[model samples]
Target: MKILHTSDWHLGRIFNQQSLLDDQAYILQEIIQQAVNHQVSAVIVAGDIYDRALPPADAVALLDRTLNTLIGEHNIPVIMISGNHDGAQRLGFGSSLLKHSGLHLFTSFDQLLEPVILSEAEGSDLVIWGIPYCDPEHVNQYYKVKTTDHQSAQEHVTQLLHEHIARHYPHSATHVVISHSFIAGASVSDSERSLSIGGAECVSADLFKDFHYTALGHLHQAQHRSYSHVRYSGSPLKYSFSEVNHNKGVSIVSFHADQSCNIEHVPLEPKRNVRIIEGELADLLAQGKKDPNNHDYVQVKLTNKEALLDPMASLREVYPNILDLVKVRNNEGSTNSERSRAQLARSEMDIINDFYHAMNNEHLTDEQRQILQNVLTELNNTDTERSSKRA
Candidate 1:
């Protein structure tokens, strides 16, 4: 059985405050075309169907159109799950009714035990266990398990699913696990939100050892965790400037009759690619003037020592979609270096005065200085009062 694996659609995502709905619609059409070309039995959308819990009406409509084209028009079976950004209850609405039409939406924890079976006439059956994004608190409450962090929570939940699979299915069937999570050692980009603080969110790759193929989400970069079978399909669009180099695409997995599987990456071409251009202002403008990719979203870094008047406005004439601009100054004997030298020869008050001058482009007036002094004196007096109380 052949299956198309993709995730992190982030349907209503915005890049640099620009709406990506048109870009999203374009790429989703490409995905549908890929499905048609591959003649795959099913499409597996791991998670993150929307950019936010409360998506806009247009985003909702786009999703509706995509699903209709896939399931209604093409008659392809689609299995999807809700990611962290998705509101589970909202996305899972009409799921029970939709399943009759071959669109499987798994959001609840109770749905993990039941597998979506995809089979071909000649190949082995593919049993997919879809697990949605579950935080530690939810997992603990649902399963009555002691899971203090993301790793522990994932481990506990997966263990239960594994036991359930073992009890129900035979050993010969091909088992696939579709989950939304941050597996350890997977590459990350700037756009992805931290699942937890201090790295407590990363789950060990060994947890997926038993599955034939593990399709994961959460991370926006397409990569393998510990093994070839465990993989992240990544987001369809470039969500950040950091992902400018990523060859965004989808993964196609073909399961053979003998339980062996083959994985292939089908690259996706976006309407306008995200790119970064760095050079001096004059050179960059010259390059942009002749560049064929003027329509692409660009981030410019000017290496000019001297400030130029309205460089962004000038660049916009050539590259209309310039999203960000920055001036890179010389490090040696620069303003920072001069500030350091001045700080060494000055008192704390002098340093503070200079800082205020630099920030506001003006020095502190007599009235402002008096007000600051009065505030400082009050703070000192309050500290002294606390000390006296302690004594």
Candidate 2:
């Protein structure tokens, strides 16, 4: 039995203030083409179906058309779950009816019990247990179990699933577990939103090793954890520069009677690939002249230290699709991680001072510093009026 696995669609995503809907639509169509090419039994999306809870109207329309083409036109069955980025109830609306059309959306908690059984006349049936993204507190209250963090919550679910299988379908079918989680040791990218605060988000990968195949999501870079059977299909499009080398694709897993599966990674070619290029402004401009794919989503890290006049305009002349123009730290030759760590160790005013120096090659005057400090203090005041917007 074989199935197509993909995840972290993150539809309607915006990167560096640029909307990626067009790129997303193109990649999704490629995934559908792959599904049809392989003639897979089912398509499994691990989660993060939408970029946000209340997605824009266009994103919703894209999803509708994509699903219609996949299920209505091509007659492919799809299995999906909700991620932390989704509004579970909203995503699962009309899901009961959609499942009849072969779209099984597992968003709510109680769905853990009702496995989607892909019955075969040959008896090599597939039993899928979909675990949607849930908060530890909600799992505790719903399951009547005390799970204080993500690890505990997942362990509880794993134990319950084991008991359920033992009581009902022990060794009867090939079990596949699909979950949206930040599993331990999985590589992460800036594109992923934090599932929980204080780094309490990761769960042990050991929990799903016994399953025939476990499909995972949340972390953008697709990879297997602990065992080959447990895998993440990754995102079809690169969502951030942190994932510049992700080799975006979907995995087609062929399951055998021995519970071993062969995975074929069918790469998704995007209309515009995300890329990062670093060099001095003049050198980059010279290189961009010879570069063929200048329309790709590009992030340029300038090695030049001094402030320049109209650098973006100069770069844009060569690379019109440039997204970010980063001013690298003065001659230290730092990696992104090093710069991030250094920023975290700095105070807000110090960070702003660095930016000021980069812009004007001067520090703030005493009076200017005092005024900025007052503004910062006022912003930090708990009594200060604040406006809220959905991120």
Candidate 3:
């Protein structure tokens, strides 16, 4: 059986303070079209259905419509899980009823071992285990395991699932596992929110060695982790300027009776492409004027020697979707260049003051300076307290 693997919809996501709901809606429609064209058995949405825990009304509506189109109209089965960004309780609401409609929303730890058995006419019985985003605290409470970090929690969960599968499922079944996590050795992008601080969130790729195919999420870049079978399908859209080079797409996995799988990436075309253009103001304007994709989202870098007034405003007159602007200094003799060099010798407070002035075009007032000083003092105290505790 063939299945479409996609995740991190982030339906209510905002890019440069601009709403991306319309673009999101368009990409989702493309995904549905891909599913129809491929004639896949089911769709697996790994996690991060919404941009935040409390999504906007329109985001909810778009998700509802997408689900209705897949499960109601197309009669396709969808297996989805909640990521760290999703409110598990909220996403899991009506999950029991929704499962009857071929929409399996797995969020709770109670459903970890349960398998969504997909029977195929030409392939072996496909057994899928959906593992949602498991916090360290949740794992400790539910599994009675002392997992202090994400790695331990994931290891414990996967071990339990493996043992359960060994005892219950037949050897001939094609096993597939769906999870949202940061596996060790996977490439990460700026768009993905850190699952945990201080690098304790990474789980070993060895945990998924037993499964025939592991569909992962959380990391925005689609990549394999230490093995071909363990992979991340990546987000369907580029959520950050850092991901401007990413070829956003979905993974189509086809499984055979021999427990072998083949995966293909189907590129998704966005309504507006994300691009970066660099040149002087005049050159950039000329290029923008000739470019057919002026409607595309852009980040411009100005390399002009002379200071331009309202450069962003001027650029927007031609490329209306310019999201970011930066002034690049070509020569090292500029005043801004000297300021950058002098900042290395300046004190932290002085540097902060300079930064404040640069950003707001005004010096920090006495009151604001005092507030910053107090904040720094509190942070230092907290650090000392942590150090004492560690000692």
Pairs with backbone N, CA or C atoms under 3 Å apart (clashes), candidate 2: none
Model 2: how far is 62 from its true place, Å?
0.7
Worst 10 residues of 2 by lDDT: 382-391
Query: Least lDDT summed over 10 consecutive residues: which range in candidate 1?
Result: 342-351
TM-score per candidate, in order? 0.85, 0.83, 0.85
Q: Pick the candidate with the highest lDDT.
A: 3
lDDT by residue (tens digit), candidate 3, 1-391:
8999999999999999989999999999999999999999899999999999999999999999999999899988999999999999999999888899999988998888777999966657999899989989989998887989998899899889999988998899999999999998788887889988998999999999889999898989888978898999999999988888888999999998789999999999999999888998878888888889998899898886543557887789889999999887766566876866764666667768866754565678999999999988899999999999999
Better of 2 and 3 by lDDT: 3
The residue ranges of model 2 lying beyond 4 angstroms of the native Cα positions read: 305-307, 333-391
- What are the candidates' C-alpha RMSDs? 10.2, 12.0, 12.8
Segments in model 3 whose C-alpha atoms lie over 4 Å from true places? 331-391
lDDT of each: 0.88, 0.88, 0.89
On residues 1-391, what C-alpha lDDT tens digit does candidate 2 reach at each position? 7899999999999998999999989999999999999988899999999999999999999999999999999999999999989889999999889899989999988788898988766756799999989779879888888888899998898888889988998576899999999888788888889988887898888999888899998888879888888899999999888998988999999887766789888888899988999988878999999888988989999987544667898899999889998887673787878976875887778767767865775778999899999988988773444543322
What value of lDDT does candidate 3 attain over all alpha carbons? 0.89
